[model samples]
Target: MATFSSKTFNSALYLSFRPGYNADFYKMLYDYHMRNNGQFDTAVDVGTGTGQVACVLAEKFKHVHGVDASAIMLASAVQKPNIKYHVSNGEDLNMIPSSSVDVLTVAQALHWFDHPRLFSEVKRVLKPHGTFAAVGYSFVMLENHPRASKRVYCLGNEPDQLGTFWDNGRLIVQNLYRSIEVPLKNVERHYFPDESGSELPLMMENVTMNHFRNHIKTWSSYKNYSEKHPDRPDIVDKTVDAILEEENLKEEDEVTLIWPTVLILAENNA
Candidate 1:
């Protein structure tokens, strides 16, 4: 697993800028196990950055334990009943009891883990046939505008400062985890479902440019660029400005963004 520098990862800005996984995403996770007649009482959210996925699991599971490597990131996680946050590496989940977890989830952070060791730990903690999901989302896309959308896509995709700052883990996500080997059996991609367990139309609308800019600024690559090129501190500002000018948009102008999420679902089969 790659070690993240607290200096590079700004937990405060990350909590503020990163989009939260919606209820639909949680519903799919909860139902994945239940639909298979597996238990749904306890869940362990590995690499539970800011406790987003763990908090969601708390609604369905009797207990939800969130474990992360960074203390700074865990500090930003919200406190809630039925939810506990712990500082631990994904590969070593010795704090959790064996065959005790009903569901194990790693949201947006699986790419950073030592997959084989993490899978072994997950299997140790999960009951037979327990669900394991690794969730990731594609680059944020802007709707209702072509020029601005293309520019944002280019910023994330093309070899620029942001591109150079991205770590190897990012490549796995960009490939939708296709290249990464999964040690678990019967793994497949799962989609988000509404509260009723039906597919929900994935959509977002009326997002302010400020909010969009904030999301871009939260990218690890962008943050890394900011740290290395402190002298070129205006890159973020200048980038956002260019988008606004090119799109003839005001700061408050509402734009639509679509973040297509992918999930790698598997069963413990213990």
Candidate 2:
């Protein structure tokens, strides 16, 4: 979280490279929230870096609030009349009135939160039976390129590479937030690639290898590693080169990428 808050972190690049949730994902969340007669008056997006999720929620909810600790990250957020951006942490949303929000969501950021405090704030701000959703995607793999996928994994997990540079919160993200408990009722966990091996429709198709390279550069681990080893060769370029060599693909070659994503939803019964 601190890494992203840094002045030098490229929030725009991060926004461009990060995979986005599709309409189906929101449909699933909205369907779950509405299952118990949930309203769509107001929604709060905590840790809403660049307002990606908040911008989308604005189309559905009457009003939306995007809260983030990093003003730099929020600076890139899309300006929407219905969406209010707040410089606040997920654990303490004092600006929002209690028992007001109909839906609260955290996208790719629940792992960085103080779970107990965040859950308390979630309960305090959410109306009775309001919905809470947390969504995240884990390691990405190149479709039909097993060798390249393995190399990419090594780039992220090997101790000698960017692995050691990642914060402890990275593990929670890698684990797909399994360790997180919403401390609310009717909690549901959903996986993109279900046990039957059907992947979610969230796959990015026809993405260039160069795009993948830049995507790796947007990682916080990559930033930290680069800062600590300024003289060393760019590990991201090296990894991408290795993948291209092993797969016999050019930088312009397009490929499909799949991210194993997870979504957790709960209801504020209190």
Clashing pairs in 2: none
lDDT by residue for model 2 over 1-270, one digit each (tens)? 999999998999988887778887799889998897999999999999999899999999999999999998998887799999999999999999999999999999999999999999999999999999999887788989988888888889999988899866999989989888779999988887777877554545458999888888988899999999999999999999988988899999999888888888899978
Per TM-score, the best of the predicted structures is 2
The C-alpha TM-scores of every prediction are 0.90, 0.97
Each candidate's lDDT (Cα)?
0.78, 0.89
Best by lDDT: 2
Estimate candidate 2's RMSD in Å.
Answer: 1.2
Off by over 4 Å in 1: 1-4, 191-206
Backbone clashes in candidate 2 total: 0
Give candidate 2 misplaced runs (Cα > 4 Å).
Answer: 198-205
Q: Provide the lDDT at 166 for model 1.
A: 77
Worst 10 residues of 1 by lDDT: 192-201
- Candidate 1 lDDT, 1-270, residue by residue in tens: 232437447777778777877666666666777777887689999888788778777877899999998888888897889998888999999989999998999888878878788888988999988888888776777766777777777787777647767766887877667766777778877543234656443434457999888888878777667777888756667778998988888889888787655777888869
The CA-based lDDT of model 2 is what?
0.89
